[model samples]
Structures are given as C-alpha cells and as structure tokens.
Target: MKITVVGAGAIGGFLACKLFAAGHDISVIARGATLHVIREQGLRLHTGNDLVIAPLRATSEPKELGIQDVVIFAVKAPALPAAVDAAKALIGQQTLVIPALNGLPWWYFLKSNSALSGTRLKAVDPDGMIERSVPTDAIIGCVVFPSCRVESPGVVRHMSGSKIVFGEPGGGSSSRISEVADVFLRAGFDAHAHENIREEIWLKLLGNACFNPVSLLVSCATDEMIDDPNLNTLFVEMMSELLELGNRLGISPKIDPLQRIAITRKLGKVKTSMLQDVEGHKHVEIEAILGALISVADLAGAPMARTRTVYALARMRAKTLGLLPE
Candidate 1:
C-alpha cells in the first residue's frame, strides 16, 4: 500500500520508517530541517542500541506525492489544520485518513452514537476547517500508545510502548479497520481493531487530559508529579471531574481515578509530550488535550470545575511563554 505520513515528527517519522521497512511504499510530507534531513539522508529510528533507516520520498508539498492509499496524520492538534490543508492532494476517495494524535480530536462527534452527534468542537476545529477538508467516510479513529521523541531532524527515538488501536468513528467492525491494524502489526506494533474507538480515545484522554497539562504547569515528569502529595491530589480531583463528565457524555471508561494514576505511576519518570513541547519551545496542544474536553463538557451540560481551573492556568502559562496564540 502507498502511505503518506504527514508531519515527520516523532510518531510520523517512526511510522514512516517502520512501514517502509515492512515493504510498503512510503512518502512523507515535512518542512524545514526535517525535510532537509530526510531528503539528504533518510528517515531514521533509534531503538535501544540499534538504528533503522529508510530512504523515503520526502516533500513539503503534498502534490508531489499524489493520492495515497492511506494518509496518517501524526501531527499535534495545534498544527493539524494546516497539515490537513497542505496534504489535501494526498487524500482521495478511496484513501483512509487516520489521525494518530493525542487528546480529543476534531471529528469526535461525527458519526458518533452520542446525543451530541454531528456537533462540532470549537476548541479543536473552531472554523470547521478540518471537518470540511477531510471526508467522514475516510476517517478511521486511531489511538497511539507509543512513547517516542524526535531525537533530531528526520530521526525518532523509540522510548517505550507500541500498542495502537483502530476503529470506525461510529463504532462496529469493518474490513478497513482490520486492514490498518494488520499494516501496523506487520511493522511490529501491537495493533488491534476495536469495536468502539471513541471509548478507547476517552480512556486515553482520561489520563492525558489530566497529566499532560499539569505536567506543563508544574514542569515535572510523571513519576515526580505522582509522587508529590499535593499534585497527586489535584490530579485525582481533575480526573474525577472528567469521569463524571464522561458519564454525562454516554462514555464510560472502566477505570477509576486512582487506578488510572497508578497506571501512570508505573511508567516511571516519564515526561509527557506536552511537557516536552514546552521544554522544546514549540507550540503546546492546549486545545486538543484540555480545551476540547471542556468544550464537550459544556455541550453535555456537565460541570468540570477542577479541570477548568487547571486548563486556565495551563493556557495562560502557554500563552505567556508564547507557545500559544494570545
């Protein structure tokens, strides 16, 4: 299959290398230093002591890549709109578009079984740009569990985790979901086709919506935050509020607040992706991770007071640091 991965960042570069190595025709849409490095050398992935590189077709303009069999969006939420607009030429009628992103996605309500189905999230897609650009039928919801970072331009360092879950947006079985899962499995990932992708997304967001923003505000790693008494208490409160909010939205993730924190505690000193973005002086995903959740809560008339407080502080922090638009 011909696959074009938009945004050659940590996850995108990792996927490109893995898929290319697995005998898929791979191309990447990237810009600046990442594009230069990929064009000169190749997409590189470092796992432990070994390094794997794939010489792939790299371009900043999506038109050069033509329509792909699959287009995987590995960009952060903040950069998604522009990435989608730029990569329009790579998506066709038969193409499958997978957003391998963190936090609540823009298309959360499209084809959903919830009461808010067909509602647009202003936090993630304020102008309906993403909703207008990508076809709903082409979308396959994906939740990535891998922890990776761009060690350098065109290079990704795999830290831990490799589970990826794929499902149709509306839920139920589909051959396309199985096909994508098989593709990832062929590239050595623990991929599964789920019946309810939205539930999986909510399960992941239950942790990310709490930890990612808090990590940015506190400027600490996962284990450190979990070990601190006050911060741990704050996390529990925020997660509890999110749990109630999820219930109102007709999504129930089977884990409690304390159990979820325990899962993160086991990850040991792990730095969240949002914290890493702040440290790198890049734009943080404040909207997708936090704002989107708050928006959904408001839509469902669910109160998320503690989560709102944390979000305000984190948003102000990112804005003051110039990592977010004022």
Candidate 2:
C-alpha cells in the first residue's frame, strides 16, 4: 500500500516508520525542520531498545506525492484544518483517510445516526473547510492509544501503549476498516476493527476532556493530579458531566469516572499532550478537547457548568502563554 502521513510529528513519524518497515510505500507531508531532517537522514523511531530508520519519500507539498492508497492524519487538532487543506491532493477516489488524532474529530457527527447527525462542530472545524475538502465516504474513524513524543524533528520516541482501533464513521463492519486494521497489525500494533468507533472515541475522550485541560491549568502530571484531593474531585465532576452528555447522545461507555481516573493513575506521572504543548510553547488543543465537548453538551441539553469553567480558564491560560489567538 502507498501511504502518506501528514505532520511528521510524534504520532505521524511513529506510524510512518512502522508502516514503511512493514514494506508499505511510505511518504510524509511535513514542513520546516521536520521536512529537512527526514529528507537528509530519513525518519527515525526509537522503540524499546532499538532505533530504527526508514528512508522514505518526504516532502511538504501534497501534490508532489500524488494520490495515496491511504492518508493518515496524525497532526494536532489546532493544525488539522490547514493540514487537511494542504493534503487535499493526496486523496484519490479510492483513498482511505484515517485521522489518528485526539479529542473529537470534525467528522464525528457527519454520518452519526443520532439526532445530531449532520451537525458541524465549530470547535474543530469552525469554517467547515475540512468537511468540504474531505469526502465522508473516505474517512475511517480511528482512536490511537499509544503515547509517543518527538525526540527531534525527524525522530519519534514510542513511550507506551500500542492499541489502535478503527471503524467506519456510520458504524458496522466494512472491508476498508478491516484492511486498515490489518495494515496496523502487520506493523505490530494491537489494532482492531470496532463495530462502533464513536463509542471508543467517547471512552478515550472521557480521560482527555478532563486530564488534558486540567493538566494545563494545574501543571501537574497524571499521578499528581489523581493524588490531589481537590483536583481529583474536579475531575470527577467534569467527567460526570461528560457522561451525562454522552448518554444523551446514546453513547454509554462501559467505564465510569472513577474507573477511568484509576486507569490514568496507573499510568504513573504521565504528562498529557496538552501540557507538553504548553511547555514546548506550541499551541495546545483547547478547542478540540474541551470546546468540542461543551458544544455537544449544549446540543444534548446537558449542563456542563464545571467543565465550562475549566475550559474558560484553560483557554485563557493558552492565550496568555501566546499559544492561542487573543
């Protein structure tokens, strides 16, 4: 399969390297230092005790790569709009687009059979540019569970977790979903083709909606946040509000707030991706992680007073740090 991974950041670099190693033709859409590094020394991955290098095609222009069999979007939420715009030329009629992103995707409500079907999430796709550019039939919902970080411009360090779930946007089985899962499985990931990918997305968002923004507010790691009594209470309240909103949308996650928190606590002193972005002076995913949830809550008529409060504070913090527009 010919694959092109956008961003060439943490998740993008990791997947590109693994897929390339598995004998798939791989290319990357990147810019600035990342593009230069990959072109000069190839994309690198640090997993376990081995450092593997996969020399593949690397370019900033999507048209240069032409149409790909599969295009994986691994960019951060804030960069997604521009990334999608730039990568439009990479999607052919038979192309499969898998967005391995955190938080709510722009296509979440596109084919969703719930009352909110066709509702556009302004938090992620404020201008509907992504919706107009990418075809709905080409999208395969994906939830990535791996924790990875960019060790350098062209290098990605795999920390832990390898589970990647794929499913059709409208739910049910499909050959495309299974094909994508098989591709990941060949690369040594714990990949699955789920019947309901939205449920898996909501389950992951249960932790992201709470941990990511709060970590930005408090400057604490996962274990530290879970250990603090006051913050722990806040997490429970925010998560409960999200639970109600999900239920209203007909998404009933198997785990509760406490169980989810416990699972995160077991991950030890893990720094969330939002915190990493803040510390690195990069843009955090405030809109996608928190703002999107609040939008759904409003649509579902669920009160998210506590979550709204945290979101406002976190948004202000990001703006203050120059990570967001004023």
Candidate 3:
C-alpha cells in the first residue's frame, strides 16, 4: 500500500519507518530539520536494542506526493488545520485518511451515531476549520496505544506498547478497516479493528487528560505525578471527570483506573509529550487533551468542573510561557 504520514514527530516517524520496512511504499510530509535529516540520514527508529532505518521518500510539499492509498495524519492537535490543508493532495476518492492522533479527534462525532453525534468540538476545531478542510467520508478514526518519543530529528524511540485500534465512525467492522488492519499487522503492529473505537479512544484519553495536564502543571514526570499526594489527588479528580463525561456519552473503555495507573507507572519517569513540548518551548495540545473534553462535558451535561479547572491551569501556563496563543 502506498501511504503518506504527515508530521515527522515521534508517532509519525515510528509508523512510517515500520510500514516502509514492511515493504509498503512510504512517503512523509515534513518540513524544517526533520525533512533534511530524513533525506540525508534516513528515517531511523530505535526499538529496544535495535536501530532500523527507512529509505523513505520525504518532502515538505504535499503536492510533490500524489494521491495515496492511505494517508495517516499523526500530527499534534494544534497543527490539524494547516496539516489537513497540506494533505489535501493525498486524498484520492478511495483513499483512507486515518487520524492516528492524541486525545479526541476533531472528526470524532462528525458522522457518528453516539448521543453526541455530529457535534463539532470547537475547542479543538475552532469554528469548524478542520471539519471544512477534511472530507468526512474518508476519515477512519484510530486509537494509538503506544508511548514513543522523537529522540532527535528523524529519530524515534519506542518506549512501551505498539497497538493501534482502528474503526469506522459508524461503528462495527468494515472491509476497509479489515484491510487497513491487515496492512498494519503485516507491518509488525498489534493492530485490530474494534467494533467501538470510541471506547478505546476514551480509554487512551483518560490517562492523557489526567497525566498530560498534571505533568504540565506540576512540571513532573508521569511516575512523579502519580507518586505525589497532592498531584495524585488532582490526577484522580481529573480522570474521574473524564470518565463521567465518557459514561454520559455512553462510551467508556472497559478499564479500571488502577489498571490504567499501573500501565502508566510501568513507563517510570517518562515525560509526557505535552511536558516535552513545554520544556522545548513548543505549542502544547491543551485543546485536544483537555479542552475538547470540557466542551463535550458541557454538551453532555456531565459534571467536569475538575477537568475544566485543570484545563484552565494548563492553558494559562502554556500562554504565560508563550507556548500557546492568548
């Protein structure tokens, strides 16, 4: 399958390298240092003791890369508008545009049948910019369950887990989803097509909404935040709020908080992607991780006071540090 992965960050690099290694025609839409490094040094991925390189064709201009069978949008939430605009050239009529992103995807409730179906989240989309940019029929939402980071430009390091759940917005299995899952499974991923991908997304977001903001506010690593009494209390409160919101929407991943915490603690001192953005003076994904949930909580009539408070604190910190727009 010919595929293009937008954003050369950790998740993008990881999936691009692996898919290329599996003999798929891989292209990357990247800019700046990342484009240079991938062309010169190749896209390198470090998995445990092994370091693999991908001889991929990468260019900053999307027009250079023609229509593809699949286009994975793995960019952070803030870059979606511009990213989708650039990726417009890759979307053929039958092209599958999989959004393997963080938090709540902008396309979550676009054509969904949930209680919140067709609801556009302004916190993330901001006046439906992304909605108008990407076609709704082509989107297949993905839940990425991995912890990886870009160790440096053109290099991605996988820390733990490698499962990606794919599902259509209308729910249940489809031929396209099965085909996509087969492609990913061949690329050496624990990939599967879920009947209800939204639940999986919520499960992933539960930890992110809690851990990412707590990491940002306290300036602590994942394990450190889980260990601190006051921060841990905040963590629980934020997670509780997210779960309640998910439940009210009739979508909750079947996982206990203790199990989720155990999974996070296993990573041990890992800096969340948001925390890393804060440290590196880049824009953090406050909207996708926290703001979107708050917006939905209001629509769903779920009590998300704690989540809102956390979102406000984190957003303020990002603004004060000049990491986010005022």
Candidate 1 per-residue lDDT, tens place, 1-326, comes to 99999989989988888899899999999999999999999999997797999899999899988999999999988889999999889989999999999888888888997879999988888999999999989999999888888888998998888889999999999999998999899989899999989989998998899889999898999899999999899988988898888888788888998999998788777889999999899999999999888888888887788899999999999999999943
TM-scores of the candidates are 0.98, 0.98, 0.97
Clashing pairs in 2: none
lDDT of 3 by residue, 1-326 (tens): 88999988999999999999999999999899999999999999999898889979999999898999999998988888889988898998888899988888888887778788888888888888778777889988798888888888899998888899999877888998898888999999999999888888889988998999878888888988888887777767777777777778888778777777778888787889999898878889998888888888888888778888888888998889898843
The lDDT values for all models are: 0.90, 0.91, 0.87
**How well is each residue in 28-143 modelled by candidate 2, as lDDT tens digits?**
99999999999999999999998889899999899999999999999998889889999999999999999999999999999999869999999899889999999999999999
Top candidate by lDDT: 2
Error of model 2, residue 274, in angstroms = 0.6
What are the RMSD figures for all models against the true structure?
Answer: 1.0, 1.1, 1.2
Please report, as a residue range, the 10-residue window in candidate 2 with the lowest summed lDDT: 317-326
Candidate 3 lDDT at 60 equals 92
Instruction: State the local distance difference test value for candidate 1.
Output: 0.90
RMSD of 2: 1.1
Q: Which stretches of candidate 1 lie above 4 Å from their native place?
A: none
Off by over 4 Å in 2: none
- Candidate 1 least-lDDT 10 residues: 263-272
Model 3 misplacement above 4 A: none
Better of 1 and 2 by lDDT: 2
Give model 3's clash tally.
0
